[model samples]
Target: MRTAVTAMKIPPSLLSWRSDSWRSDGRTDSFSNEYFKRRNQLKRLLFACLVRWFMTAVLVMGTYLVLWRYSRKAAMISNKKKEFNTLIIALSIALGLNIASSLKHLDLANFEPLQRPKADYILQSENFSCLFQLGYVTRRHWVRVYVLFWVLVNVASQIAVASLGLTYNINSADTIAVTTPGVVAIPDMSNIQTGKVLSSNSQAISALRYTANNYGLVALAYGFGDIDEMPKAGSLFNSDGDLMYCDLNSCYYVFYEATPDNLDYYQSVATNRSISTQATCQSWRVLKGGDGTERTITIDNANKTQLTIPALNGGSQTTFMVDPDRGSGPTWGHVLAFEASATDPWFYNCNVTIGPVTNVQNPLQDVGVNVTSLAASAIALQGYGASTIGVSFNSTRHFQFQSYPAESYYGGPQGGNNTGMGQLMASFAVGVVAITAQVNTNVNATGLLPLKGIELDITSWTYVHIILILTVGLQLLLAVIAAVIASKVTIRDHSCVGLAAALQPLLWKLDNSGSSRTTCEKRIFERLGDGVKVSYIKGRSGLYYIKADE
Candidate 1:
């Protein structure tokens, strides 16, 4: 013990009272000498130990703080989890709103043509698109969420509706009946004349004679059901007011042309032949049976069937129903009707009366008045009578009719655009699952991927949302608490605050060994029996040293 104590010699600078207690302030000070001489050994050792412990505490806290600060940034890089969440929300909103709006537009696309613009009409008529745009723009947010909810809700609703549909069956006249295979034809002929008090055979003969006379030119040449030429009026009559006649059950002679000279010759040559014509024309004479000359059919007049006035070919009219109370109107298209007569009757009477018929066209009045009024009146009307049971609706509803809600002309994705929310959600789920699965196989499993990831199935979306709400919200809450605790413990505790504020920089200046340099110095001087030679150089600030010859 005596030998160990003798071998330990303090450094020359530490031996001096000035160097032990005082620090250099640009130059050596006299106070340094006074302090060293006055201070005791135990006080110096205690101060040294306090400084070492303070520096050690500061370094530990600083490293922990650095790591904590970088953790959020690292999470941003290794896991795009938050980004996917935001993306899913935005995409869901965009898709849901557009889809719902599209359906709403479809419901009313053809109800009022003016409400939906023509393909090029949006640019041409701002008035037309204005109504459509107004409907959707204000409704965008609710519509999007509504659409998504609808998609989910509709799955259940459709199943219920399907079960309901099974309760009743509805079909149109297009259904086939086993009793009838084809159209049944009826025959009538009051057009042929020249008869009174005649027997069945005589009446039949008269009918045969009349038909042969009228249609004989063609029948005599080509037999019954045959035309020698497209028929002409005078083809069957001879100059003598006689006919090229045929009896029932015989083929007849051909008479393409005839004059007075050939009448007898024709009669003799046609002795073995007789032909009959099928005349289908019927006639009805409506004598003025009613009290007044001005007569009306009164066809369900209270129900208001639109009777198109009689006109020559290619003519029409336009009209509208205006609600006096509501200040609104529904414009309409033309109507049509036909009349018939008998003389010169085969096809000429009704044909001449109503000129050539053609198809009618209109945007609003595609369906006739009867159907249009039923659909239109079903909605709320301003002037509906008190007696009316179901004029306008109290709430909006979806109704289907043939000519009413035709295909919509607005708010649809053009040309195969995959802009729906369903697709976006599906894509995010797929991407997340893929990355997470890859990382679970490849990287350390402790990463963020293990904590926040999802599968590609939409059926599981609700559960995923629930999990996210619980997980993220909980994490945010915990992080807030943890940050508060960490800050108080790190920055507010008296010793920790002092260590950080006071001793951190001093330890930072200790070169490679840092604050451990004192241990290294003690081992060299006290245990190794080494002495260091100090060299004084003018204007130098710190001690310079070399190992003394051992």
Candidate 2:
């Protein structure tokens, strides 16, 4: 047995300990300097295993916080997933730095240190699989096992972090409703008479003519099947923003009130916006030339009729109209034409149903007010009181309406180079609220705006935010616990040079035993069969070393 041990070249450092403890070799001065340099092992390990891990966790969680908010516009990466991926990669690298610190952390894995496999300790530091092997190998000891488990926990959190992309993929919401930092336009009737918008030379008249061509009116169908179910959709961009919509139900109308932005203050802050709505809606459809005579079609003023694309060109036209019921103040009237031609009829007489909307704070519910002559004269206004009556709103809501904005009139993506209120509200409705290079020839029309909605009612969203919060939150919790439990004591360096230095006494006593002089360490370890058992020693002045006994 002794001869075989000798042939195996087992170092004296592993076989037995010196009686003096301090070797009588010529390396005392070198050993003393090395031991003194490694004194703050505990502090270093604390920072490595705890401070670093927590910092990484915070960074990861912070990234998720940004992603949860759809309103957060990123200046750097436009794509959501690309931005998240970049952040994950950068923070993960920061997390990886802790691995080096953990190599020496095993020395202080527990308060009362005991003998373990030295080769296993050193091997597990750099190799991932080796760490698991050490974990299983040290399963009998609670502290070491948990320490290993802590590292695994960190790894698990990172995996969870990696799965964030997948989570977004699987759980992304199709549509999101939020009150955003912007504006929606509803007409202010008070300005109409004072502004002389009806005058032939008025800016509104010119804008109206341009609107005829730029946003040509299309006919829509209003199902009489359920007028009682007034459209909950609140936007006019797709359908009329008027109270007169659907089969024929009376309405309690409220609208977002905003003035025409001069394109300078295009993005209106929703929090500061004033809300107003009309009590009822009255729609008028006027047809000219198709049936050989000018005919004014009046549908149920209490309900909206769905329209189809009006027949075009063939010398005929169908127009949708808006008659802002003249209140005590001067509210204007609107004529939206299906075809833009100088000869096409304009209604000075009241026979057509005007797609009218007004501002009312409170409107009596389930009551119908049919104002066919919304803007006839002050004499008519005196007969009924203000065209739009004011009421107190106990509870009002901003409902949703699904509408696509009028397409580029010029017919190309390289649209106008100025954001009209018309297209500005349209862009963000798709996400990425922006008013980019939108332009038009008519300066009056370009400056005027259509109603743009700000996010107020968030009924749904693009991604499942609650799930993401819970998952990332859970990841943070796990990471924090692991960091606390892994308060390691690092005695030796994790680098190959530091590891070699720690085992110097043993290495120095061994010689190449294989016939091949250039044999690798792998061959030598294989010949040794089971690896060496190791124990630690506290020498003079808190110096530490790995030693073994036969």
Candidate 3:
């Protein structure tokens, strides 16, 4: 039982039939022949190639012409007098056009419309109006031009601003250190419960007072530095209404007035308030967050104690000394710290209780007895520079720390207080260093060989490259368009016989036995080609042409 096997090659026609079968059903183009007009296709392809080449040539020539023309015009105008006149006239015309456009779009004001709209909570919500204000700016040519000019002006202005910053002599910032007592031990303050009012009026006063009493507050005197020269000792004074001279301390004249510290000032501020639960007055707690890097100290009016020290002079740097308590091992305490402007020193609100405590053992000695604590003996006080001021005081009441308040209460002339001069010099020095660092140059260090590279090179490089690319691209594009227009003029569509000859292959024939009859009838009705009409009427086959002799 053997099976016979046969192999046969398919004919071309058979293969064509098989290909047709393999064609995707319902997917073949329905009107593929519509684009197969050979004569029309030839004309279009020729036109496209002509247009492309013409455009390329026109672009090249136009760019060269524009640059050359502008350069020649600039060179010919030698006298500043003529140049100025031309420039002014051109600027005036441009300005007038800009003004007219602005006026045409001006929105007139009406009293009713001018009335402020009620605050729309929906619109005010960040979600509804995120970046919506950007839409108000109109995008117009004049506006763009104005913005460009403004940017250029600012670029030039920065030089002057930088120079001013360099010239401004900054004195060291002023910082005050209020003396405090060292905490030997925590005196079993666990018996004192939270929310209990230590004041007689049942009003829960700030526990900071008791804490400061047990554990002294160590306040850092910032912005304090060496002065050019010390002022007369006649400027220094004590709280006892007596002028005291310290041979060890240097004094300096200050421009602002001072206020003597007294107990009456404290009592006047912390008055009794209505009794409330600790929960209700929970706002009194100075909530500290993070590693004290960013802490918030919030106190309500009822729980707040206001003690007005001498008002600081407005816009002036003050100097003060950082004096430590003798025999008080590493005095540590909590104090309200204040930060000055970039040019000023970090100041402290001297805790009235923490400074020169009275009505106690060793009263009026200004001992470091005010703030002692149990957790840590050595506390940090703020010093000059942008460093953190960390200090643990005598009181076990630990509070985290962070940036200073948004505003300062200082209100006198700089250097008015005797202690302000040194502080001013120190603060100024720190501020200068900060400014120098911000400018990316270290003070007293030879900046990099190219100082500008550190400050502005990157931005300058970016803009330079951008300008180069844009200018080159724009020139090329403009030249292209110009060349295209110019080429359309220069490259006349002179009928090229060669192009016409090349199209001969796409010709078609209309002469046939039946078509000849039709052609004769059409030529007769069209009143064309009398010869062709006659030829068609005579039943002769030939090309149809119209002539007078026909």
Candidate 4:
């Protein structure tokens, strides 16, 4: 009937795809989007992990450097290179292990997003079955626990080692021996005369027999005043077998019995015109005595305050004569004597030429006895350089004189006296004695002496070794844990639909099959109906329709 034909129009979106291929194409696109999204998420997670690991590495490295510096300095101070090296090695291994464990993701190539999948997907997908596995979490927790334990143990070990190594006890003993000389002063002895007159010249004279006016006589001489004053000369002994010249100046004159040969030797040095012409005094060796010689006397004219007298019989006897009147004549009255035997030869002496004399009590009693009180002139012998005598003295006792060489007149031969110059003159009045003698002495004495030292009861090596072993064990555990976590975490191209939304599609498919859906599916479909859009193609028709829609 001649009707005009009209062209039918189709939607551009629907015209491009066949109804059967639409579902496949949509699924591929969705899967691709989900895969890219998951990949991007995993990349972000990996970046964060890398950043965290890098910071941890920096912190660990900084801590290690600080510890290394401290250990190096301590090693230098204590000279413990081995211990320092051991600690450094252990720390290095521990740091290495930590770094290695942190890099586990890179080693395993596991860049997984930690997103939770739908319960239905979990139940249906074999790949996502292990999402909630406790193995990974347990391993991570245990690794942390072990690392914490290791750190605590290491600290405790270090403290224990340090405490053990640093503390110690010391037992000590020391010996100190001292010897001092005695002093005797006889003042105001100018009028006393106990010997025969030897000279009438004003020049000072030596007391030796050879220096006396009588060249033919073989006898010791003693006196005060100038040679021109006819000073007396005397023998040391008298008719009653007692000391003949008991008068102060005469009795103290140092005497050495001389043979004819000794006399000739003295004359040779004394008569030298060059020596006699000098304005300043000079020293001359005048006498020596013994079987061959047991004593030697040297007279120093310039230094009249001291004499060099050596006891050839292995004795420490020194004597010095003092001039109290401050006259231009020879030294006359006071005598400072030092006596030390060879068997106990310990001597110390100090001479104080100027300054006020002060009292000195026992200061080193624990080390030795302070025998400074034995001297008659205690003040002069109290300070440094003063000899320490082993003998004790009282201020009330009369001065005791001990002679060497066994003089039959004074007493018998005395042996082994523990007295030095200071002790002998320790009791003297401070200012009364013009010249002071220095005495130095020591003996075989024993006492406790304090000394400083370090004892290593526990070594750093022990602690270092323990830490190293524990660190290695923990590091191994960390490696295993890292592997487990790396294996357990998984990434998959999951649909973007949520659990309830995904259930709607299953309900529709089940309903299309002419089967009643389960109660759980019905509830899921009802709850997610408004939130989901489902697409499908009409059978035997070219039109696409939404099976379910929000």
Candidate 2, lDDT over the whole model: 0.32
Q: How large is the C-alpha RMSD of every model relative to the true structure?
A: 38.0, 18.2, 30.3, 26.1
lDDT of 3: 0.24
Ranking by lDDT: 2, 4, 3, 1
Give the higher-TM-score candidate: 3 or 4.
4
Judging by lDDT against the true structure, name the best candidate. 2
Tens digits of per-residue lDDT for model 2, 239-281: 2223222221111222222234454433211111111112122
lDDT of 1 by residue, 1-550 (tens): 2243343443432112223333335334211111221233333333433443344334334433432343223122223434444444443344334323322221111111121112112212123244344434433464345334434432432333233223222221111111112121111111222132224323332232222222211222322222332223113223232222222211112211112221222111111111121111111222221111122212223343322211111112111112212321121111111121121100000100001111212121122222222212211111212112244542222111011011211111112122221121112112211121111111111100111111221333344334334333432343334333322111111233322322222233332333445655444234323232221111233321111222
Candidate 1 local accuracy as lDDT?
Answer: 0.24
Per-residue error for 57 in candidate 2, Å, reads 5.7
* Local lDDT at 91 for model 4: 51
What's the C-alpha lDDT at position 360 in model 3?
A: 27
Which portions of model 4 show Cα errors greater than 4 Å?
Answer: 1-46, 54-296, 299-550
Deviation from native of the Cα of residue 78 in model 1, angstroms: 5.1
Candidate scoring better on lDDT of 1 and 4: 4
